[model samples]
Target: MLDIKFIRENVDLVKRVVKNKQLDISIVDSVLKIDEKKRKLIGEVEELRGLKNKYASEKNIEKGKETKLKLQELEPRLSEVEKEFLAAIYKIPNIVSSDTPIGKDESENKVIRSWGTPKEFKFTPKDHLELGTKLGIIDTELAGRVVGTRFTYLFGDAVLLQNSLYQFALEVLLKKGFIPVLPPLFINPDVYTKMARLSPETEIERYAIERDNQYLIGSAEHTLGPMHMGETLNEKALPLRYFAFTPAFRREAGSYGKDTKGILRQHQFDKLEMESFSTPEQGLVEQDFFVSIQEELMQALEIPYQVVAICTGDMGGPDFRQMDIESWMPGQGKYRETHTSDYMTDYQSRRLNTRVKTKNGVEFVHMNDATAFAMGRTIIAILENYQNEDGSINVPSVLQKWMGKSKIQTK
Candidate 1:
């Protein structure tokens, strides 16, 4: 949620940014109206409460029957006003950064730059689905029968390939001074929504449990983000680094038809996420650290990729600035996003109530998060790029030891 005060000051800018994100502006208008009503109620409620207190403290209690009645009359109204204020606060979206580009969808998104040319194949390249099945690495149909669509069973050497990604990502992140954490797998909506990078339009992506207050985490960033919730930390610990590995879940709603054929997207998948906390004084530096780790991971895996700065319209409120690492997929004949790095610049910490107290006093900490690795997507990238005509995958030199072979040969 955005601070009502900030929204009040930046209504025009908020309206424009909302348009760029391809979001509904009507809700934003309603929020502003609700905010106005709440503000008026606060002043009115405070005045009535002060008068009630004054009346109660007056002398000559035998003559105070009229005062008692007036105080009782004001109580219900004050309660009603507080309820409205709380509701308005919950609906407010965080203020987006000023630099966001004005556009709708990825087509409108500006490409800052790209890296590493797409690999040229001497032979016709096979898509991941064809390559994986032929290599005896992925069994989508059987797994779909056992569970459902969008689920897969990794066979042959795929398991080792997936494990190898986690091993490599964790090592690189740790060397960057990131503390490895195993966060809680589930969290209540109050905390989840508090730091989550979700919006009203994207609500379908979230998986909420009807039976309980908890929801399965979509990303480790959710847990890592609220770690300092409602707490103040020392200034010296300004840039706190953390890396986590977990099986992330999503409802995958609204994305019904796209990428349903392969593990390009899935409901449950493993990922290595990196999160950082820094003071306003050191936010960009912390952001660079995250970007560096993403690049380092790609280089170590020997994958060709490009880095692009996301336009303001492409980013949500929790992210003040964003960048994506897109890997080359020769089979797909194009680059696709595999990792994203974000600089949230106090947006999340403020909402989650995570603050730091320096010599100058308390302030919200800026947050940064990046995808160090997603096991399934990484596997897909590897299978497509490293596939051989004989249904084999030449393991990257870095991961050869982990797979226990130089190549994965289909039986």
Candidate 2:
């Protein structure tokens, strides 16, 4: 949610942003009109309230009965009007950064830079699904028998590979002086709403216990960002860095055709999430640190990749600005989003009430999050980049110790 004052002062600018992003623009107009109605209603109601107070002190109490009765008739209507105004104000989005490029979708996204080339394959390379099935390491069919589509069971080497990725990612983040935390897989709807991650459209991708009013977390970020919700951290504790590991659930609604063949678009997957809380001056610096860690993690895995700044349309409503690190997938012959390092500034903090008390008595902390490693995508990068002519997969050196094996070959 944006500050109501900001929206009041900049309705036209807000209209331009959501319009360029292809969102419904009428929402902006609705907000402005409702706010106007609310202001007038408040003044009227306050006058009535003041009159009621005045009657309480009247020289002749019975003489004030007519005015009191009129106020009683207006009170309920005033209450309803105030409720409508607040609802409309909450619909407005945050102010977008001017540097964000205007575009309709990801295709219009600009590639800021690029890295290592896709390796030459002596033999046509197989995708992760083909390799997994051939090695009897991934069992999607049995997974279907047990839990239905969009779920899978990993065995032997595939299990090792996935576990290796998690262990390696956790170690890397820990070495960076980040505190590791494992949060509850199930979270209340209220907390989800506070995190600004709850959406009706995402229900299909999410596993929700509607009766319990709880949602399975879709990303460790959902927990990491709100960990300090409604709390005030000391300014001296400027940047509280945290690394989180958790299994994410999503219903993958409306994404029927893309990434359907493998774990790339699963209903459940694992990830290592990095988040931080900092002062306004410190948000970008924390973002830079997160980017450095992301680059290092990719380098450790020996994956070729590039970093690109997200356009205004691509930055979600809660993010002020974002940058993504796309790891090179040789088989796909393109870079895909592997990690996104973002600076949300006070976008999320305003809602979560996670603030810092500066020595100067200032408040409202800045919050930021980045994907340290989204397991399924990392595995895709691994298989595509390190496949052998004989159908073996080479474990990246950094993960070899954790994997306890150098290469994953069919038995």
lDDT of each prediction vs. the true structure?
Answer: 0.77, 0.80
Compared with the true structure, the alpha-carbon lDDT of candidate 1 equals 0.77
lDDT of 2 by residue, 157-176 (tens): 87788788888877777777
lDDT of 1 by residue, 308-367 (tens): 777655666566677788888878888888988888887778778888887668888888
Worst lDDT window (10 residues) for model 2? 86-95
Deviation in Å, model 1, residue 326 alpha carbon = 1.2
User: Judged by lDDT, which candidate is best?
Assistant: 2
Stretches off by above 4 angstroms in model 2 are 51-79, 200-205
